[model samples]
Target: MTSQPSLAKADSNPSSPGEPQSGGTGDTGDGLKAGLKNRHLSMIAIGGVIGAGLFVGSSSGIAAAGPAILISYALVGTMVVLVMRMLGEMAAARPTSGSFSTYADQALGRWAGFSIGWLYWFFWVVVLAVEATAGAVILNGWIPAVPQWGWALIVMVVLTATNLVSVGSYGEFEFWFAGIKVVAIGGFVVIGLLAVFGLLPGSDNPGAGFAHLTDAGGFMPKGAGAILTGVLMVVFSFMGSEIVTLAAGESEDPQRAVTKATNSVIWRIGVFYLGSILVVITLLPWNDKSITEHGSYVAALNSIGIPHAGQVMNVIVLTAVLSCLNSGLYTASRMAFSLGQRGDAPKAFARTNERGVPRAAILGSVVFGFVAVWFNYQWKDTVFDFLLNSSGAVALFVWLMICFTQLRMRGIILREEPEKLVVKMWLFPYLTWVTIAMISFVLVYMLTDETGRKQVLLSLLAAAFVVVFSVVREKVRPRVDA
Candidate 1:
């Protein structure tokens, strides 16, 4: 990490008519130039969308909604596509290292900037903690000698060092990490579809038809209620998808990179998420008790008599966990750096080291990862559950902020430089509002589900915390003299 922490500026005083304007441009480090290539960004878009959660957590969602759970993936994927389009429009214009948070500040207000920036920073820091635990669990399950905590410690320290080197290195690292996941999941989908058609090595079990959808209990075995429930269940798996936009800020051609990634992200998401889920459902009965009993993809692979299926899945899940942790640390550090630059966080966070890494932000995020490990180790069931529930519903908050920023930013683009609108969000405000309404409905439905209710409640508290901070800071800042 850079010794000079790159944080948002501490004083968010807007440039007055007579005052000289400065600061708020992002990533001041020197070791790395903006050199993230298009290929690197493309793989990130493809691989980042398919998180390990799809393989593991999607099982519970499938169990809840039966075969129709494919609808849940389709629904959430569409929402994200619209959201990303909105984000793409703004990013194509500004292309700052600070990403959405800085855009929120410039478009919405200083308060919106600070709140979203810090909240996003907080989100990723917590994710670092959570992902470390996940990676540790997989490693421990595989080796059974080194404790999970030790493995987590190793993962954190190594990734921290990696981020501290340079942004280019981090991009390169994520490129490969994401590439492995892409190949694995993509291959799984192909193999799964083949097995579904009864073309695989063993065809004892009838899998080559849509009969799996209705074989056990028809499409909505648990009723339509569970499909709404499945919406909440599968949404968070898409969390890492937004990181591509953040990294694009540091790319050599931010506008071009963001535009290309944004344009293709929807189809990529549809293929990876909807396509993969479709294969899973067609290959196995959603109502099969084993679907709910074991990890989703792992269980299905076992059904197909794949050799070393569990171990293979354990490796894949472990890779996804590590990739997420690496990205989480990077995201948190960059946000804090942006916050410092914007005058919302301590100024030290804005400084970057010789290698152009945000040293303080990286270490600070890693410290949180360690703390989360302690909580996971000590409380195991309850505290872990609480942590998961609290952050679960904030996916909407993050996405909504991106959408709103884009709405305001679009006008700014026309007034300033219309040339940058090379990549645009289709059906601007219309799709924007539709997306928001869809998110709101999901929130309302979540409030009604007993399981998702906990997540909704915890998320409300988190948003309240953000709102209170924004209000207090707005009140405390000195008024500008005319």
Candidate 2:
């Protein structure tokens, strides 16, 4: 295997004022160019907090837990906040495209890094196909002349070209895409709140009020146990929140970008997730049939006499799907590049073009993504389901690894470079351990349900396969240190 040098030593050496940092805009120690500006980082961070799942998947959570689904979102959101904190502590000190994967290698071992990094890349590539299919469905609806698969191919190719160009191009596309989603959600929340209080003029809002929260079945319709079920339903929706940490590595000021994203995550989750869900439950009773029939967001819009609500929401959802596709491609490729640099992947993946783009890595990820899209078209039930289930639980695994890595990395950072601890994990080992336990509880709880159980078993099988491969690779060709 190629050399796997210690990042601690590399990051410890201060760069001259004239020389750009490893991931900075000028020629990096690694080949990647820093093309992301502060504005791009800010928008990416905000966009990461809002995902397509929030719009598409909240209906089932509300159906299962009644209005108390807010609690499930809060619990999962808090878990994500803690995980991002631990990640931020490491990322701010030593920024890299690898993000938690590299930190795992330094704190745990090569096996951990190789496994998590590849799993993360796997997760995003799968997401690309999933999001591409979703976007295509909407596009095919607007223009029936184009088939769903045709739209999917068009969307995937366009975004792939965007990523292949430069990091700035990717950021620019994401900036506007995310901006539209933010405005849509923000508008929905504001208008919904006004209508709920009987303040909006000329609207049939069913006299919407706080009574909707409890009048149906006293907050939780299916008893308290459903909250756990709701947790299972909503947990995966928060998967994209960590993408900001990975994107920060390519920013002009990675440490500052990391710190800002970490600090703002709380309010971001509160406003985008908890806040919007609160509006939905407040505007319409949890047991309302329209919510399940027309979807949570659309139902709320319909209740307020909004015109063409479905189409409007379709447009918003399409924007979200495209944004996810854009970011997923960028994220998967960067992780692959990082893996190559660490000697965990092919050396070609580490090479860059004149634009400082990892052409090989980007194309590699897109090629797999396109293949997955084909699988979705040709054999969605068999091969596609296997890919989906195997990747379903990786978000939890990544978070759990971050918690473990932070526990060990905190001491290492304190001993080696105490001054660089600009973003410390809250409450140290105590909160970190609590976060770990919560994630473990969620994973264990997944086994109780049929769907969740299938996902866990399949994901574990995939993880074990990768771990075994990593061990064998290490034994045959041990990593060399630079």
Best by lDDT: 2
lDDT of 1 by residue, 1-482 (tens): 10111122312433222333333334323222465777788887787787778878998898778888888888999998888888878777766657888777767776677777877777777787778888888888878899988988889989988888888777888888888888888888888877888888774446657778787788888888778888888988998777777788667677777888888887888778888888777877786677777677876787777878888988888888878887888888877777766567765676665555667767776777678778888886787667767777777788888877777778877776788788787887788888888988888888888977888899778778887887787677642311
List residue ranges in candidate 2 displaced over 4 A: 1-6, 10-25
* Candidate with maximal TM-score: 2
Q: What is the clash count of model 1?
A: 31
lDDT per residue as tens, model 2, 1-482: 22333556533321222233345436555777878889999999998988899998999999999988999999999999999999999999888888999888888888998999999999999999999999999998999999999999999999999999899999999999999998998998888889989998987896657989999979888999999999999998888777778888778899999999999999989999998999899998898899899999999999999999999999999999999999999999999988887778877787777788889999999999999999999999999999999999999999999999899888778878889999998888899999999999999999999999999999999999999999898888856443
Instruction: Supply the TM-score for candidate 1.
Output: 0.90
- For model 1 the local lDDT of residue 93 reads 71
